[model samples]
Target: MADSTVKNTYVKQQITDAMLNLLRTNELKAISISHLVAAAEVSRISFYRNYTEKEDVLREYINTLILGWHVEYENSDKKSEEEMLGSLFAHFSKHGDFYLLLSQRNLFHLLKEVLKTLYGPKPEYPNFGAYVAAYFSYGLFGWIEEWFARGMQESAEDITILLKNRK
Candidate 1:
């Protein structure tokens, strides 16, 4: 089990670097497993040993980020929602390039799940939490994608402030 864990870590690290480097030039759809293995200098068996698909690589990376957000939230002062979001954006912007690459993947489901976890059970809405989760997840991701497309023209705080000011 320890050996498998170590191997997985090594394979994942290699694949993550290869994918990110490839992302600088190639779209995710364009990057085949063969290309990834070659760039990562890992065997096909090794790749499959750690991940079933290329998208799994991205999923694991995002899981780390979302977990980090949860940790930050727990450590943070219980302030207004805007402040927490602004802080989260600041962290997101800190790793802007990786996130820009990440944004291309269809992470809507992931975001929706996380938002649902964050917001929990809100009985105030007539449609239950599904509608609210979808609205927040899609809207928030769309907003960030636009911000990223603009080359993150404004600071994270500015972006969050814009959202906060929205009527």
Candidate 2:
């Protein structure tokens, strides 16, 4: 089972990478599974085993990339908010290309949902409410999108520091 899981992850990454490479010069609609199979150098059977279509590969890749960090946040030992946010930034920096393409494709609806996971732990303060979570959900995502647009020039550590100091 573990071997299957590993192989599945490896093949899926290959397919997703191929799709991104294709997206460099072609729109999503213009790229077919055959193109992906050829580009990835994987068999059509391998592609079908991992994904139903080119978009599925990209969508799954983005969803996994976003959700994995939130899961880590939820499961981690107690840590400072800066450290947690820095971890998230580190993940984003590691997968900068994926996020960059997702941004260009305007495929960020799932990002808000992923960020909404942070709302699960509500506080008792007057300023802490669903409204505040909603505000952060939207505002933070917009800020992040803009940050990516500015070329992500800051290191993850620097980003964490800036965000921590931001009013």
Candidate 3:
């Protein structure tokens, strides 16, 4: 039983590495199952066994990345609001290419899901906490897109300062 779980983990890691490599050199739209299979050095059957489609692979990758951030935020008692924002910005900056590609309107829904998981369930329509979470997630995504498009000229410190000063 444990052996199968370990093997599955290994195969998933291979697929993730292949996807990251392909993403680095090509647009997301350009990546196909054949390319991913070839890069992973795995058969089509292997790829299919793990993922239903390329979109599934991408969804898994993004969710895993965001979940890790959520876990860090949840576990840490010392992270101030500024530190949390800085950490989020730093993460997006490190994976700017991935975020830029995943910054479409549809992807914001995924961000919203992550927000719900991180912040817990929203209240009624006028709930301030819910509103803030939605605004922060959506706005932060837009901010990341603009930063990447501009070649990320600002340092992380500068960006962190900007976030800190926001009302």
* Candidate whose lDDT is highest: 1
The alpha-carbon deviation from the true structure for residue 61 of candidate 3, after best TM-score superposition, in angstroms, is 1.9
Judged by whole-model lDDT over C-alpha atoms, candidate 3 comes out at 0.73
> What TM-score does candidate 3 get on C-alpha atoms?
0.75
Q: How do all the candidates rank in terms of TM-score, highest first?
A: 1, 3, 2
What is the per-residue lDDT of model 2 for residues 42-71, given as tens digits with 9 covering 90 to 100?
899998877776666766766787778778
lDDT-best of 1 and 2: 1
Q: How much is 82 displaced in model 3, in angstroms?
A: 1.7
| Per-residue error (Å), model 2, residue 61 | 1.4
Q: Estimate TM-scores for all models.
A: 0.81, 0.67, 0.75
Please, what are the lDDT tens digits per residue for candidate 3 over residues 1-167?
A: 99989988888889888987877667667888898988998788888998897777777887888878778776878478788877877777777667665553234345445545554435664687677877766677566657766667887678889878887
- The window of 10 residues in a row where model 1 has the poorest summed lDDT is 106-115
Candidates' RMSD to native: 3.4, 4.5, 3.6
Q: lDDT tens digits, residues 37-129, model 1?
A: 999999998988788998787767777777787688778885787887787788778787677666565343444455555554456656856
Candidate 2: C-alpha lDDT:
0.75
